[model samples]
Target: MLKRFFPDLYVDSIYHIPYETLKKNQIKGLVFDIDNTLVPFDVATGDQRLVTHFKELTRLGFQICLVSNNSEERVTIFNQDLQVEAIHKAQKPLRRSFKKAMKLLKTNPKTTAIIGDQVFTDVWGGNRIGMTTVLVRPVVDRDEWITKIKRGLEKKILKVYLKNSNNQ
Candidate 1:
């Protein structure tokens, strides 16, 4: 059903998420998708702005984790400096990785949120686990071919979702 792809919140990007609002709601942990969520896939590392933003989040006492379907090599190299708990090749839209992410954060479903650019994987998985899901627009136009294909389908879904939301 379309509900699986419906995010609890949709924003222009991760930067647009209201951290204070989430904190007020008692969200204690955040699970993020690496590529195109925090940074574009082509960027070798998080930029200065992203680094500062993440530092701020940590300073505010939020546990963070990177749950990416990307290979260990890519995730490892990208996270060397970030140093957050991370799981690569997460096989998302499945419950196992979501549970693993919660354990890594020492948090439970009620206090955790998933932030990513993809609906099928991030939104669906988070929604299935009763976690709040935040969908952000992709950072770049270029991506792996597989993801590019998903983008096409996601466009259609988003259109319907937006239309329905407006009707409501």
Candidate 2:
């Protein structure tokens, strides 16, 4: 149950994630959430650091795709600038978008991982599809109202989970 709620993996920051770790995990592809994960929600494009990381991942032979709940306009701006395939209005935690992303990457779920800041959408959707899920702290905490509420609940659950883990 705890495993179901928590992400399969956690990283301090997406930039710090090692390519070797993904290789060891047998992850040949990755689906990423854009806003607040790769960059702040308010920011329109990725920073130089993120662009460099993306290049490194591509060089490492890992297929990358962006799956975001944001509008097409927003995603288009990202895709055009980042030069990567992306699906907007993903409706994550539903599996449809993730499936579509996998189709685009031509990678099997067994060799794919989903990385994002939010547990409810990114982690849940990845876990539902039997893919490894990675959770990173949000690049920025300010978010939409619904997301803020969800984050609050997620925080509570995470606190409880940590307390229990410490006790055991």
List model 2 lDDT by residue over 1-168, tens digit each: 756667766677897676698889789998999989988887888877778888989999999999999999999987775787799999999989999999999988899989999888998889899888888889887997889889987887678766776696
Candidates' C-alpha lDDT: 0.91, 0.86
- Reference-based TM-score, model 1: 0.96
Clash count, candidate 2: 0
Model 2 scores worst on lDDT over the 10 consecutive residues at: 1-10
Error of 2 at 7 (Å): 0.6
Candidate 2 matches the true fold with a TM-score of 0.93
Cα displacement (Å) at residue 49, model 2: 1.2
Show model 1 residue runs off by greater than 4 Å.
none
Give the number of the best model, judged by lDDT: 1
lDDT of 1 by residue, 72-109 (tens): 99899888888999999999989999999999999999
User: In angstroms, what RMSD does candidate 1 have relative to the true structure?
Assistant: 1.1
